[model samples]
Target: MEWTLWFSYILLSFVVITLVHSLLLPNLSKIRRIEGVPLVSVLVPMRNEVRNVKGMVDSVKKQTYKHIEVFFLDDESTDGTSSALELAVRGDARFKVLQGKPKPEKWIGKVFACHQLSEAAKGDYLLFLDADVRIQPEAVERALGLMQQKNISLLSGFSRFILPTWLNKLLVPLQHFFVLFHLPILLANWTKWPPATAAHGGFMFFERSAYQAIGGHAVVKENIVEDVAISKRMKAEGYRMWIANITSVASCRMYETNAEVWQGFTKNIFNGIGRSIPLAVGIILFYGVVYVGSGILALAALLVEERVLLLPYLLIILQAGIVYLNTREPLALAFLLPVASVAFILLLVSAMRKSVKGQQVEWKGRYYG
Candidate 1:
C-alpha cells in the first residue's frame, strides 16, 4: 500500500512538471510582413460543412496577407455546403470552389480531397485548414513570418477551443491537455526524433517544395490521423518541422453536441495513442489510477482513518490544478477532475474495444474500416 502511494505520487509529480513546461512554452508571434509577398494557397476540404463554410471563408477572405488564394473543395457534401461556399466567395477571383473527385481505392476522404487541392495549388506555400476553424486577419501573415524567420519546412499550431455546450466545456480542453502534457514542446522542436514530432490538422503550413518532397497527403492517404503521420514523415526525411501554440490567432469549434464529441473522438483516439492495445490499456489504467483512483482512495482513507492515503489524493488535485491552468480551463473544473477523468477513461476503453472488434469508425457520413 505504501509503495502504491509512492508510485502515484511520482506519476502525479511527472504530470505537474509537464503541465508547468507547457505553460512555459512560448506562443507564436506576429512578425513584420516579409519584403516580397509570396503566393500562399489555402486549402479547405469540406464534406457536409455547410454550417461552417460561411464563417470559415469569411475569415480567410479577411486575411491581411495579399498574395493568398483560397481553394474550397467540396467532397460531395450532400448538404448546402457548395451553396454556402459560393455565397461566401461571391465570385471573388482569389477564392475558387472546386468539385472533389470520388475517393480512390483505399484512400481516405479528407486525404483524397487534400491531394486534389495540392495538385491544383499554385503557390510558394500551402496551408491546409479545417472548415470549422476561424482565423484572425493577421493569422496568415503571422504564420508565414514565423515560418520564414525560423526556416521551417512544415509548421503546425494548436487552435483554441470555442466551447459552447456543457460537455464541450468539460471535454474540449482535453485536446490541449493531451498534447501539452504528454508531448514536451521544447524537446519536440529540438529533437529530430519521429516520436517527438506533433502536428494539428486544423492548421498545417508547408513550403511547396518541401511538401512535394514529402509527397504531401499522398503518403498519408489512408491514415485516419494524417496530421501526425505527415509530421513524422517530415521529421524522418530531415525536414525542419515546428509546432507551436497559435490559440491567440485561431480557434475551432470541433463538435457542438455530446454525440458529436463522442463520435469525433472515438474515430481517432485509439490511433492517436499509437494504435497499440497495450499502450492504450496502459494509458487508460494510468489515468484511472492518478485521477480517479486517488480520489476514491482519499475518501476511503478518511472513512477508515488512514492518513497516509491523503497525500496521494492531494497530489492528484495539485496535478489537476496545474493541467487546468495550463490548458486554460476554468479552475472550478478542477473539482470535477475525478469525474472528467472517469469519463475520459470510459471513452478510451470504448474506442479501444471498437478498434479491437474491427468496428468501422464513422465520421462525416463515411466509414473508416
Candidate 2:
C-alpha cells in the first residue's frame, strides 16, 4: 500500500515538474507582420447562429485590410440566421454569403462547409473562422504578419470568452488552465517536438498551398474535431503550424448556461481524444486518480500527522498549487481542481454512455455523434 502511494506520488511529481518548467521558461515565438497587405479570404461557417451572425459579419467588414474577401456559409440554419447574414452583407461588396449544401453521409457538417468554402475561395491565403467569434480591428492583419514572419503554413490562436455568468467563470477558466498547464504551446514550439495544439476554431489562418498539399478538409471530412486533426496532419506532412495566445485579440461566448456548456462540450469531447471508449475512460481515470487522489493524500497526511509521508504530500500540494496559479482561474475555483477533475471524469463517463448506444450529440440544434 505504501509503495503504491509512493509510486503515484513520483508519477504525478513528473507531470508537475514538466508544468513548472513550462511556466518558468515559456518560449513564445515573437509575432511578426507582413511588410505589405496580402490577399486573404475569410471563410465563416454558420448554422443557427441568429444571435451572433450579424455581429460576426460586421466584425469582418471592419477589418483594416481592404484586400480581404469574406465567405459566410449558411449551413441550413433554420433560426433566421441566413436572413441576418443577408442583411449584414447586403451593402458590402467584399462579402459573399452562400448557403451550405446538405451534409453528405460520411462528412461532418463543419468539414463539408469548409470544403465548399475552399472551392469558392479566390485568395492566396484562407482564414477559417466560426460564426461566433468577434475579432479585434487588426486581428487579420496581425495574423498574416505572424504567418509571414514565422514562415508557418498554419496559424491558430486562442480566444477569450465573455464570462457573463458564474457558471462561465467556474468552467471556462478550467478549460484555459488545461490548455496552459497540460498542453503548453511553448514547449511544443521550442523543443522541436510535434506540437500538441489547441485552437479557437473560431479563428484560424491557413496558407492555400499548405492546405492543398495536406489535402485540406477532404482528408479529415468525417472528423468532428477536424481542426486539431488538420493541424496534426499539417505538421506530419512537414508543414509549419504555429499556435499562440490570441485571447487579447478576439473573444466569444461559447455557451450561456451550464446545460449549454455540457451539450457544447459533448458534441466533440469524446471524439476529441478518440471515439474509443476505453481510451477516453482510461485517461479520465488516470488523471482523476493522480491529480485528485494525490491531493486527498496530502490533506490526510496533514490531519493525521503522518510525518514520514510529509515530503511527498508537500510535493503533491506544491505541484497542484503551481498548476492552479498558472491556470489564472479565480483562486477559490482554481483550488477546487479536485472537484473539477471529478466533474471532467463524470462528463467523460456521460460521453462514453452516449457513444456506446451510437447516439449523436446535438450542437447548433443539429445532432452528430
Instruction: Output the number of the TM-score-best candidate.
Output: 1
lDDT winner among the candidates? 1
Q: Which ten-residue region of model 1 has the weakest summed lDDT?
A: 24-33
Candidates' lDDT values, in order?
Answer: 0.84, 0.74
* Candidate 1 structure quality by residue, lDDT tens digits, 1-369: 778667776967676676766765656655655757889999999999999988998899888887999899999999989988888898789999999999989898999999999999999999999999999999889889888887888889778888777677667777766676678777677667889877889999999999999888999998999999999999898888888888878889999898898888898888887779899889888889777887787788889998877777776566666766754567676666677778888888999899889998788889975
lDDT of 2 by residue, 86-203 (tens): 8988977899989889898899888999999999999889999888788877788777887787787888865666666655665565655666556755644433345566655777
What is the TM-score of candidate 1?
0.92
- Estimated TM-score for each candidate: 0.92, 0.83
Error at 368, model 1, angstroms: 1.3
TM-score of candidate 2 relative to the true fold: 0.83
